[model samples]
Each structure stands twice: as C-alpha cells, then as structure tokens.
Target: TNLEKRELVELSTRGLSRKEKLIVILYYLEELTMKEIGLVLDLSESRVCQIHHRILFRLKETLERMREDLLG
Candidate 1:
C-alpha cells in the first residue's frame, strides 16, 4: 500500500507544470497547509484552493485512465 501510494504520487506529479509540481510537492510531500503553500507561492489562499481543486480533478481523470488501461 505504501509503495502504491508513492507510485501514485509520482505518477500524479510526473506530467505537471512547474507550478503545479511545486504545489503537489508542497502540499503532499511537505504536508503543508494550503494557506502556507499560498504564502510560499505568493498566491492568495483562495487561489491556491482553486488550483488544488483543479489539480485534484486532473488527478482523478488520470487515475481513471490508468484504471482503464490496467483493466484492459
């Protein structure tokens, strides 16, 4: 389970933009709060929230695709 989780995170960040990569690393790896991430990235907290949500949606899509590929 741990290995799978690490792989999932790696896969999630593999194709991200630089800013998106940073956000994921900060939020997941560094375990930072969204407000803290916003401060580090010089973005408003709400903006970080928006971007995080978007990132999550993209991840969901990616996961779905991977699941389909695996089940094929």
Candidate 2:
C-alpha cells in the first residue's frame, strides 16, 4: 500500500502553508540539512527544527483524520 501511503501524505501536504510545504520539500525531498534549510529560509537552525516538528505534528493529525474519514 505504498501508493496509498503516498496519496495520504500528498493529501495531508495540501493543508500545509507555503512555508511549511517548502520546509518539508527542502528537508525531505531535497535532502537538505537543517542548517541548509535555515540558510535557504533565512531562519536559524533551531527555528527550522521547530517548524519541522510542528509540520510533522500537523501532518500526523491530518493523516489520522483522513484515515478515519475513509474508514468511516
């Protein structure tokens, strides 16, 4: 079910703001380090980590909600 998992992640990303999406792409897709992401975003490394954590938490909630809706 890798395709389904990818679909769910795609759907969840739709709820992200522009900056959040950029951070996700830069970090995961582009394989950027936190320091590199911060340089690209003009933020400190700590801030990038904070944003990353928040994005992950939000995505987790969104994916869970989507799964529940589909199941129901």
User: Each model's C-alpha lDDT?
Assistant: 0.88, 0.84
Q: CA lDDT of 46 in candidate 1?
A: 94
Candidate 2: the clashing residue pairs are: none
Model 1 scores a C-alpha lDDT of 0.88
Encode model 1's per-residue lDDT on 6-46: one tens digit a residue.
Answer: 67678888778898888888888778999999999999999
By TM-score, the best candidate is 1
lDDT tens per residue, model 2, 1-72: 657755655665787889888887777667899999999999999999999999989878877998999999
Off-target runs (Cα >4 Å) in candidate 2 are 1-10
**Cα RMSD (Å) between model 1 and the true structure?**
2.4
TM-score for each candidate, following the candidate numbering: 0.81, 0.78
